[model samples]
Target: MGQTSTSLCCIFICFMLAQTVFQVESANILFFFGVSSYSHRLPAWPLVTGLAEKGHNVTFLSPFKAKNPHPKVVDYAPRKFSEWAESWDEMNMFDMRKKGDMYKQWLILPYFGIAMCEKLYSDEEFINWVKSSTYDLVFIDALFNECGYGMAHIFGAKVIQFDTTTVFPWYSSAFGSPDETNWIPDMAYVFGANEVTFQNRLINALIPVGWDLFRSWIYFPQLEEITRTGLSTTDLPTFQDIEKNVSMIFLNTYYSEEFARALPPNMVSIGGIAYVEKRTPLPKDLAAFLEKGNGFIYVSFGTVADLQKMDASTQQAIIGALQSFPELQFVWKLRNDSLLKEFPNGNVYISNWMPQQDILSHPKIKAFITHSGLIGIQESIYNAVPLISFPIFAEQDYNAERVHRNEYGIRLEITTVNQAELEDAISKVVNDSKYDPDFKFTQYSTNDA
Candidate 1:
């Protein structure tokens, strides 16, 4: 009996030891965020940093290097492709808004994607490093980085797609997810969840199919050519095959905010990865400013919107609206400080950069006037702050529609943002109890740390 008990104890000890070993085991992960914008990189930071913290060695490749990077995370900023970001800076979104032709916008994507691939391929040092290293898994930006699929193939690593935005319309066929355009609106459209008209549905259906054809017939061939040349081998899987075989997709979407849809088993929603719930102490002057005049509302058009480009009428309208709300202070984020002279009101606090997270979490923040970028929308929702969306470009309109449909805020067209409309939106969002902060949505965020 004593010998039998000893053997059982020994077996239990061995089992626990094996479990500990398995828990601590780490793998080499390659995270490639092809986009250089801070908006794209911000969502991926928590994941990369978390991996490094868990003892996994992460190799991060992007044009923008992270600040206060982890010791285990190696960053490589390829200089050649960094210039492509300059075009984004020069992209006049105001023009796109005026033209109202989405096809023109779509045409630019193929060129941008192809150019990015060619630039990355031409970097011999980066190519050599890719050849020399071994990666257990490769995480690629799902937006404009199809070349990363080939890189994963080179290292014989499992591929994971990191979508900074919600799933694209064409991602249905690629990722084996449902399109369900009958109710689910396209990201570019401002149709509400319940406002899916026949015309909206027809356009939504046709848009995804057309986009797929463009990608498959035009974009994929050029991308594959550059990818093959980069890898120095033509004998590799096509983009279609690689995309279909992706091990998993880390989608930046949540059901609490998005329409419910069936997703493939391999797809995971890790939305709100960038949202910080804990409130940080605000600076003294900023804190004092917010406490005055029946609390303040924060206004920001995000990183890309050039407020200086706004026509004089629109600019004056915005200024007039801000002045009209004298009882309530306004904190505006403008990139160009020259506009500061125009906003010379005691109630309006204009700054080039504001601590967005801290501002949202402040007790005195009554509402957020935003460009309706998904990141900003998510941050505002998690903080339980109501919004007044002045959508600029891209999916901002779509996000604003959701805000409007959900009764969390209102959406206004930037092109026609007059003082009357702006004042009405502010008044509705501030005084309406239905638009007040609902803390329940905070539970929807998948941020563990």
Candidate 2:
């Protein structure tokens, strides 16, 4: 009996020691993000929240305020851009529509880069705050050209790149993931060829080589001054080292969304991170509007897609389309008050800010009219609602194209949208058994996958 009791005590001590070791080795992650879009913010929120729940310390750096700040978070707001420059509404849609001129949009990358540099260099308060804190891991959104990669060198920490969309060849190359292929599927199925082509294959090969030379010549000098002490210059990690050093890559897309792509072992697809938490309660008015539902449709052009850019005729056409389908309730998230005032009927409910998640989860929401932003698309998938995708800009075109190709929704390009086409698309999504069932089935399959 005495021997058995002594053995049990030894076993308990071993278990306690193991638990202590694990608690000590657990990661302390610092997340850096360019909160340019709400969609970009959503994907990281769950991961940050999850790490915090596991008792890991997380410090998030962003330009905008966090929607739901966690206790473990250390919010770092960078310098804001000028009002005119910050207004995504003012951005030239015609210019954005142009393809293959990445340098023209180079301004976007630098804008966030400068903002991050300012926070790291000029913001004495933030520098003091970070210097006092300690982190073992750094998670940076790939688009944040300034902070994440640079900080890993400065702090001697392991960096993880978090991609909010499809893994672009340029980024894949930067991570030293082999420049073997470039023909990825088109997020939007516009062109005849696969998303990537022989042309992109050449471009993919050149981008890393060019970027390395460019960074070595131009970017590294500036970064060196900022990161290094006056006596010693810091050595930047090679593209291969960055890739090799990363613990994991988190993708916002699921397997169903990204078909026919080779994913690396380090890459994890936790697509619906935004929907991981229970949704917040809807406002009283919005809740009442949904509760009375004879089956309603939710419409929004997403954050970056300027609904204000739509001509008066287009707005009227959308209103006319909604009016045509009187039996179906319409919950339109309109930015313009004039547009809302034009549709003040009992059947139509209009709000400048609709609780998107709550609205999508509502039982009465039969279909979503979206600009096909990744977040909106994911939400629609999560809710198993059919989509009327009107792609406006960026990957939205790709998202809409995929929705149509997948048979989960209909696509109506903004440039060609008319009242009849809009009405027809909504009607088909609502009444067609094929569309909704396929959407739900795809959702279920994706979840299982």
- Please report the candidate that would top TM-score against the real structure: 1
| TM-score, per-candidate, Cα-based | 0.90, 0.81
At residue 40, candidate 2 shows an lDDT of 80
Off by over 4 Å in 1: 1-23, 192-195, 437-449
Candidate number achieving the greatest lDDT relative to the actual structure: 1
* Model 2 lowest lDDT segment of ten: 185-194
Worst 10 residues of 1 by lDDT: 440-449
Q: Candidate 2, overall lDDT?
A: 0.68
Query: RMSD, model 1, all Cα superposed?
Result: 3.9
Deviation in Å, model 2, residue 87 alpha carbon:
5.2
